[model samples]
Target chain A: MDISFTSLLWGFLLIIIPTYFLHHYRTGLVKDTLIAALRMTAQLFLIGFYLKYMFDLNLWWLNVLWVIIMAGVASQTIIKRTNLSLRQMFVPITIALICSVAIIDIYFMGLIVRQDNLFETRYFIPISGMILGNMLSANVIAMNTYYGVLRRERTNYLFRLANGASAHEARSPFMRDALIKSFNPTIASMAVMGLIALPGTMTGQILGGSDPDVAIKYQIMLMISIFASSLISVLLTLALTHHKIFNKYEMPI
Target chain B: MIQFNNTYFIYDEKPLISGFSVNIARGEKVVIYGPSGSGKSTLVHAILGFVQAEQGEIIVNNLPISPDSINEIRQLTSWLPQDISLPYNSVRDMILAPFEFKANHSRKPSDQEILAEFDKLKLEHNLLEKGITEISGGQKQRILLLTTVLLRKPILLLDEPTSALDAQSVDLVINYLKSLTDTTIIAISHDEKFINAFDRKLLIGQF
Candidate 1:
């Protein structure tokens, strides 16, 4: 059932018809979409080559190294996406993502899956990627929401401080707000997951010939992994980076 | 006591207050009068540690204002900024927000006491149950004033507290403030009526 490289090349023809229509309409997104498709194709092929070697080696240290690199990239992406200063944010975010990824991936492998070799590439790499990807989005949302509200309503924050609130007390509401805003989308999507859309990992598992029951179980476990990792990463990043965002007088930076 | 010794403040690289000096003994009610953009608000904020004086020292009760001392200084002063941005929740919540802080947690007022103060300030008791957005700006200002006074801080720094209020409410507030004979009041105000109630008037914008 797998498509060969020749068949995949033919698949490019299917994309060209829509791209032609887009060009005719002067949508101006034709170049961007074509570029994006080309990038995706090239990047996936490169990763495919790298991952083949990675899996063949199956060295625990190498697997851990791969996950660490994934976490580093996720941290950088989160900072870049939020338009925050990377120099101020990247280190804390990397620490947070790495800590969460290591803990969650270990829990998933050892306790949940009960694997004898926890760092086996087949289970570790893809699962770690899922957790890091989800955590990346959550961290972006949390940072943006927290800083946005603080910046916009800075006077309100100071007013609270002037009225006898300690800095921690004053920031409680903003912290709660940011966490809720960050978790809301994930929670809502979880609520309607199967009815609205089959998740990609679950679909991929089924398409790859796994039994439906086994695929569903893995899907549930992965969702929990993603949720826990996201929560841990965001909270840790926020806590570790709080000092950077506020001055000594507790003013919003 | 509050003292500003040759304080210099610059906003956006332009000097707003330069070589400014002032002194007020404890329990004195001083009103700073200035036109818009004259840095009167900035002067008040500097005392509250919201704005820093670029040069010279701002001393309250003989203690200089610094990052380490700002919290303690602020605890002794309640500053009401010109822009009254209250939480859009029940009026009671907005007023009680300060009390929830550990510093003031023990000073949480009874509902009866809060309602009585609201009545005195011309704020309706029903407004306490309503959302803050339902109230007028004057009501919000008075609620903030009420919250400040309830803290019973020794020093009060108010920025145009009566700017949103009517003549009658202004009189009520001025009188209530006047009755606090031992409290130090440093206010920024333009209303002739409110200014007349203060013990001393400092005219800014001379620079």
Candidate 2:
């Protein structure tokens, strides 16, 4: 079912059709597409080798350490995409992601699937990666929306405070705004999941030669895990960091 | 009562107010007037702990405005900032929003009280059911004033409260505010009528 190196190289021939069309139409994207294809191939090849060895070793500490690395990189991505100060957001985002991903991964491995080896690298790493990857988008949306709106409508926040609202009461609307903006896309995706598009995890599982039924079950589990992880991570990060974002007078810092 | 005891405030390393002293007594209506960016609004913000005074102290009702006491002081004072930013909710929700806070939960205004204040401010009772965006600027300004009155705080800091009002509505609002003899009022305004109605007027950017 897998293509060898020669077959994969032969697959490169298919790119000529799109490249010729792009060049003829002056789309200006042929170079970018080719470079992106090259980068993807290189990165995936490197990771394939790395993951093979790591999975072979299958040490618990290694799995945990790898997940921490993933969380760290995810935190960097979240901060960069949200245009927040890295120093201010890094630790909070890292802690939030780690706590959420670990909790969900543990629940999935130990309780839902009840694997004999709960910390098996194959089970923990991919599941944790899936959850972490999904959380990055939600975190970016929530933090960006919350801080962006707060900056734009600072007077609105202060007006609420001037009306005798406590800090929590004053901030509740913005928090609700962030949560709704971030969660709506995921919720919409969930509503149309199997009918409109086959989810990534299910497709990957089927490609890896698992039974279709098993792949469907895994996809549902992974989707739920992603939803739970994203919710917990965004809320926890916001709760932990909101105090630092404002001055004593509840002004945006 | 509010007192600025030799207060000093700096913005971007430039001193805006230094060794400034002013005392507003109970029930006294004081108007602060100055050119824009002359730190008049900063003075009001300083009283609320939004702008830090580099030296000296600002005392609201004899309680210093500091990080620890800001919440308590804010609860005792009602402020109408220059921007009358109202939520997109119905007029009733906007007016009743303050009561939803824990500090003011017990001080919730009755419908009759709201109606009375609305009548005094010349607001139509039917506006309560309309969204805040549906109201005119003058009407919204009056609604904001109505909210301040409903808060029933002992001290009031109003930044250009009548800037958006017409001549008649301005008079109506200023007269209604003047009638609140029990409240200490500190206002920032350029309107001669509003300033003349005050007991004292302090000019910023000079001694």
Candidate 3:
């Protein structure tokens, strides 16, 4: 957590060699590398400043506000991906994002992790960020799959509906396909967990001088919580936002 | 039976079909002919519950149609739109799309039945496994037409089914549609040959 000038200098130096090599390996990666580097530095610096104040206060409302902000940003990103106008999607997107992140944060911090203090910024903030990250990805896939598949296979979906299929039934195959693609990484990572390697969360704990057993226990709990939260968030977003995305007659927005 | 009781539909406040009342009897073959922008496609879509009439009761089989009843009405009709939006699947797969519904899943025709149907359409059995994305428009029309017929619905709404085809395919389609034993046929066409084959025509424009 130290942010000395030496640390900053070393970070820049570390990136120089890798960025230079990437530029050589892929001639087109120069712009992409520069953008990513700039984004990372700006985002991390802002986050560090924000966290310094939030952790200094360590108030529950401040922690919750930050989580909401993150969720709102994630939902906005999802909205930007679709064909629908941004103004039309605000209500549904916000509902899905807030409901998802709040429920996930509560479950992760309150029930599973069981912090000594409910407002512990260290425990709540990092966990909420991780959960939001997973939820963001799942929602994007759900959005892409739900609308993209409808556009691509309009006839099939129409035929199904015309054949007395409800929206849920008509869209089941595409939804299933999209969910599979989105969740494949997490599912695979779970299967290869202990056998392949230690997860980053557990490694972080061990690096910070916690007992291996304690880190292992925390990792198991977090993984389970993440899996459950992700399932509910993805399912809820797909279900709730669908009504708004379609007109009463099931026309695309 | 389908009856439009003074159906008034407007798209973006521009009236498409206003006070349009039309009754299509069961087992009737009716062709809808008009120029572009004549609301032919819109009418067809309204029948299938794809579009909502602004102010009218569309009665089907003696009941005022609600959104809940749309499924039942749709079950009794087959539609082949002017544009085919078949996905990246095989021709055989596309033909079998309708029957994948649970209502029709159990009733998929046997191989012999399918072959017999394909034979009537002059479709080669080898094309069964061919990719749908690779098929010609003519082939797509024929297959889609065949699939609709297989639904065993009493009504058919064809939107320019022959517009993109050669003379032979048009002849085949017109003949097939005309010769069907007992089905209510609604075809939207401007072709002279297609018009000559129809028993009754509703010319939307110049009336």
Candidate 4:
């Protein structure tokens, strides 16, 4: 099923269509898009080779170490994308992602898949990557929304606090707003999932020669794990980082 | 009772309030008058620990305003900020919102008590059920004032409470506030009538 270099070069030719449209429309994104596509190709090729070697070795500790590295990169990406203070957010976000990914990995591989080795390369790496990828976007949306709402609605928060609300009570509204905003898109996509769009995991599995029934089951479980992990990680990140963002009087510093 | 003893506040690396001192007795109704940018509101905010004094001490009800005592100080105070944003959909929800907090749960007002305040504030009975967006600014101001009143806290801080009200509504509000003999009322206002209605007037930033 391996595509030769000649076939991949032909695939790269498709970029001309986007480049032409971007240039003709005066969008000024042609250079940036070209650079981005090149970077993507290079990065994926490197990862493809690396993953091949790691999978061949199939060492459990190596698999765990790779997942930990993924969690760290995901945490850093979330912080950078959300425009939060990395020094304040990095450890909390990293710990939250690690904890959530570990929980889902244990539950999925141990109980559900009934695999003897929970850290098997095939089960551990891809499952952890999928869950972490989903969590990265969810945490970005949640942290962005939470901090944005808190800043925009400072008066509302102060009003509640001045009128005898505890810090938790005053902050609950912002938390509620963040949760709703972050989850709405995910929930909507879940609702229309197989009907309008074939999800990536399901499509990949089907193309990879997995049975349709098995692929759908895996997709279902992956979606559930993603939802759970994202929720747990977002709550944990907020809980851990709350003191860093607010002062002793529960005011945003 | 509240006391600001030789307090100083710095904003934007400048002294907005320096060496300012004031003592408000229990059950006193005091109005603070000053020109714009005189830090009048900041003075009241210091009581609730929203603005920390760079120097000196602030005492509220015998407890110093500090990180440790701010919650207790706020629990005893009800504040109406100058600019209002209604997070609730209806007036009734806004009125009951503060009471829903655990700190204020014990003092939750009854329906009759709320209706009584609505009557006194000259707000219509139907307005309670109306959407917050449907109410006029004056009505919104009165509704917020009513909420603070209903809290029955020992200290009340009103920042520009009558800015949106008409002369008649202002009179009604002043009269209602005058009736609360046990509350320490510290109001910031430029309205001559509002200043006259209070028991004492302190001109801030004259120096």
Candidate of highest DockQ = 4
What's the distance in Å from true for residue B121, model 4? 1.7
Higher-DockQ candidate among 3 and 4?
Answer: 4
- Candidate 1 chain A: minimum summed lDDT over ten consecutive residues — where? A244-253
Global CA lDDT of candidate 1, please?
0.88
**What's the TM-score, to 2 decimals, of chain B in model 1?**
0.94
lDDT of 4 by residue, A59-135 (tens): 99999899889999999999999888899888988988999899989999998898999998888998999999999
Q: List the pairs of residues colliding in candidate 1.
A: none
Question: Better model by TM-score, 1 or 3?
Answer: 1
The count of residue-pair clashes in candidate 2 stands at 0
Cα lDDT listed for each candidate: 0.88, 0.88, 0.78, 0.91
* Chain B TM, cand. 4: 0.97
Per-residue lDDT, model 3, residue B206, is: 59
> Could you give me the TM-score of model 1 versus the true structure?
0.92
Candidate 1 — which residues are off by over 4 angstroms? A6-30
TM-score of each: 0.92, 0.94, 0.83, 0.95
Weakest ten-residue segment in model 3 chain A by summed lDDT: A82-91
- lDDT score, residue A19, model 3? 81
**lDDT digits (tens) for residues A47-161 of candidate 3:** 9798888888999888888888887787787778665556766667767777876776676667777776766898888887877777777777777876788888887677677
Error of 2 at B163 (Å): 0.7
Task: Report how far off residue A50 is in candidate 2 (Å).
Answer: 0.9
- How far in Å is the alpha carbon of A12 misplaced in model 4? 3.4
Candidate 4 chain B: 10-residue stretch with minimal lDDT:
B198-207
Candidate 2 regions off by >4 Å?
A6-37
lDDT of 1 by residue, B40-59 (tens): 98888888787889999999
